[model samples]
Target: MAQMTGKQYKESLKKVKPVIYYMGEKVDDITKHPAFIPHINAAALTYDMALAPEFEELCSAKSHLTGERINRFTHIHQNHDDLIKKVKMLRAIGQQTGSCFQRCVGFDGMNATYSVSYDIDKKFGTGYHERFKNFVKMIQTKDLMPSGAMTDPKGDRSLSPSQQKDPDMYVHVIEKRKDGIVVSGAKAHITGAVNSHGHLVMPTTAMREGDKDYAVCFYVPIDAPGVMHIFGRQSNDTRKCDCSMDQGNCEYGCVGGEALIVFDKVFVPNEYVFMCGEWEYAGELVERFATFHRQNYGGCKGGLADVLVGAVYSLALAQGTAKASHVREKLAEMIHLAETIYCCSIACSCQGFAQPAGSFQADPLMANVTKLNVTRNVYEIARLAHDITGGLLATMPSEFDLHDPTVGKWVDKYMKGSSSVPAETRMRLIRLIDAMTCGTALAESMHGAGSPQAQMIMIERRGSLERKKKLAEKLAKIGDQPVLIC
Candidate 1:
C-alpha cells in the first residue's frame, strides 16, 4: 500500500494502545478522546489530502529509498521544487485545519536524522544511514504519525547537561548493553506527545565530549513500556470540555497539545538506534535539524496568518464595518503583513539548496529571517485583527447568555451591528477570531519551531555583517578588500 487514507489511519490507531493522560484522567481511546479527538481530526487531514487531486502533487512524494508513493511528510525533499512543494503543502494543511496539526515535527526529524545519520556514518564508518532508512521505510509503509521529541526539560538554562542539578534532566544513556541502550530522562513541550503512533527523539542542543550520554538519538513506539505523557494546559483549554462557542477552532485541536513526555529507562534495540555517543557530530546534527525546523515556521505561520486575516475581514462584515475607511485600511495592513510572511516562505523555498544526499534545505539566513518575520508579523497581524474587531472581540458575551430565552431577544437586539447580519452569525465570527488570536494560535507563531530568540540567534550566526560593511566600503573605496562573509 502507498499512503494510508484517513479512514485507514484512524483504524490503525485502534491497534496501538498508548498510555495517554490529559486533564485528570487516563485516556484509553486516543482516536476518540475529547481532548485528543480534534488533534486526531487535524492529523487525519494529512491523510485525507493525499487522495485529493489538487493537493496530491504537493502533499505526497515517491520515497527516495523504497520508490513507493508516501505522504510528503515521510519523503525526503530532493530539490528546490520539493522545498517549494513542502511550503505549499504546509500552507494547504494550515488552511484546512486552521490550527496546528501536530505532525510536521516528526516529518522534520525524519529528514534531519536521515541527513545527519548519513553524515555521521561517512565520518565514522557506521551503518546508521542504512539503519535509519529501514526505520523510515517501515513508518511510510504503515502511514504512521510519529511525533519528533527534541527539547529537554532543561531545569537550569545556565548549566550544561553534565553540570545540571539533576542528571536525568536531559535525556541520557543510563545503561549500555550489547544489544542497545537504556535512556532515562524526559522531553518537554513535546508536540503531539500522546497522540503519535511513534516517537522519534534526538538531542535538543549540541553536546560536548563528557555529555556523550546526552547525545543519543533514536526512535521508539509511543506505547513503549515506561513511557508516559502528561498533557499541558493552554489558555481557555477547558473550553474543550465545555464544548462551547468562542473557544475558537473548537473543531480543530488547540495549538497541537504539547505534553511532558518522560522516557524512564526506555530501551531500544541495536538496529533501531541511529546516533549514539557521537560527540563531534552533535553540533552538525543540531544545526541541520534547527535550520529545517526554522524553515517550517514560514509556511505554517503564513497559512495561519491567512486564516486570521480572513477572520478579521469576516468579523468586519458581521459588524457592518466592511465599508468604513478605517476598517478598509486596517484590513489592508493585515493583508500586507500576511503577504510579507508568505513571500518570505516562498523565497526560502525558491532559494533552497541541495544536500550531499540529494535532499534540499532552505537557505539558513532566509529561513531564520522568515521565522523572525513570523514573530513580529503575526503579532501585528493580530493587532490589526483586534483593531478591526473593536471592543466586542474582548467583551463579547457568552453563547449561553445569548441562547437563554430570557436574554436571547435582548442580545439579538443590542449585540448586533447590522440589521442584515444575524446576531448568531456575528457571534460565530467573534468565536473564530477569539480562537485564532488568543492562547495556542499566538504561541504557535512565536515558538513553533523555536522562540523569537532562537531566530535572532540564527540571524546573528548566518547574517553577513562584514559583507554588508564591504558593500558600503566599496562605494567609497575605504577598505583594501572585502573578506568573504559566512
Candidate 2:
C-alpha cells in the first residue's frame, strides 16, 4: 500500500501483543477490551480520515526529508501556515472524537525532536537527526502510532532526578554496553500507551550536567521485552460495563484512557537512542515539546468545547429552556468561553517562527496564553454545562432502568422535560454531557497537555508580561526610555 491505509495500520497492531493490565487483570487482547476499544476506535479514525479526499490536504503532509506524503502527525512544522494547519487539523480530529484522540502527544514530540536533533547535530556533530528521520520514516511507512513517553515516576516532586530517593524515579541509564543501553524506570499517566505501536521516550524534565544518566531519550516497540502497560481508573468508567445511561461517550472511555507504562531493564538498541548524555539540551527539547503540546490542547480541546456548547444548547432545547433568557445567556457564555480558547490557539499558530534548522515553532507567548486560557475555560465551560444540564444529570436512573419492564414508564414520564422530546433522547444527551463534563473530560482539560500549574508557569516564564508592563509604563509616561549600553 502506498500509504498504509487505515485498515493496514490496524492490522499491523495485531502483530505485537502488548502486556496490558486493567483492574488487576492481564488483558488478553487490548483491541477487544472495553477500556481500550474506544481509544483504539478513536485513533483508528485518525488514520482513516487521512485517506478521505476532502481532508487529505489538512490530514497529510509532504515529508520534508523523504518527499513522501505522510500522515500529518509525522510532519515537522515547516512554516507558519503549517503550524496553523496543524492546529486546525487537531481541532477537526477533536470534533470527530469528542475526546482526546491520544495521538497528538507523540505527534508533537516527534516533530519537536525532528527539529531539535537537527540542531543538536550542528553543535555536537552527532547523527541523532538522521537516526530520528529513519525512525519517523519507519513509523510513517508502517502507519504505526508511537506514544510519546516523557513523565517519570518522579517519586519525590521536590527532588531533582539525580537526588530522588530512588534513582529510577526518573528513567535513567542503568546499564551501558557496547551494543546499547538498558533503561529501567516507569512512565506514568501515559496517553494511549497500550494502543500504540511504540514509544518515543524522553526525560520528564530538564536535567543538569550531573543528571546525565537521566537525560537519555529513545524509541522502542510497545511490546519490547520488559515493557508493560497498566490502565488507570476513571469516575463512572464501570458504566461501560453496567450498560447504563451514565455510559458517557460509550464508544470511547474518558480522556485518552491513560495508562502507566513500566520499563524494567528494557534494552534500547544504540540506533534507537537519540539523546544519550545530552544533558544540557534536555531542557530545550522539553520546552519545545511542551510548547507544541500546549498549543495542541487549545486546538483539539477547544473544538471539543464547541461540541459541548452545542450539546448543552440542544439539551436546553429538549428541556424547553432554549428560549429562556437565563439559558440563552448560559449558551452565550459557553460560546464566549469556547471562542476565547480557539482564538488563543489560532493566534499562536499565526505567529509561528522558524527555528535554527528552519522548522517552524509556534509563538511561545501565544501558545502559553492559549493553554492557560484552555485550563480556565475548560472549568468554566464544564460549570456552565452543569448549570444548563441541571441536577438530574447526577440522579438520573440507569439506561437499563429506563429500559426495564416495570420502571420504564415511570422513569420516562418524570424524566420528560419537553412534551414533544422523547425521554430516551433526552437521557442520551444528558449521559453524553455527564461523560464530557463530570468524568475524565474535566481532568483531561485540567491536564491533557499539562496541569493548570504547568500552564501558569509557562505563562509566567514565556508570556510577555514584561512587554505588557513596558507598554503600560511607556503609555502612562513612566520608567526609563529604551536605552543601550555603549
lDDT of each: 0.83, 0.84
Supply the global lDDT for candidate 2.
Answer: 0.84
lDDT of 2 at 56: 81
- The TM-score obtained by model 1 is 0.96
> CA lDDT of 63 in candidate 2?
79
Highest TM-score: which candidate?
A: 1
Backbone clashes under 3 angstroms, per model: 1, 1
lDDT of 2 at 277: 87
RMSD of each: 1.8, 2.0
lDDT of 2 by residue, 398-432 (tens): 87778789998999998899999998888888988
Q: Which number leads on lDDT?
A: 2
Q: After superposition, how far is residue 256 of candidate 1 from its true place, in Å?
A: 1.1
User: Model 2, residue 103: displacement in angstroms?
Assistant: 0.7
lDDT by residue for model 1 (32-148), tens: 666777777788888989878989998999887888889888888888888888888998888888788888899889888888898888889999999998998998887788898
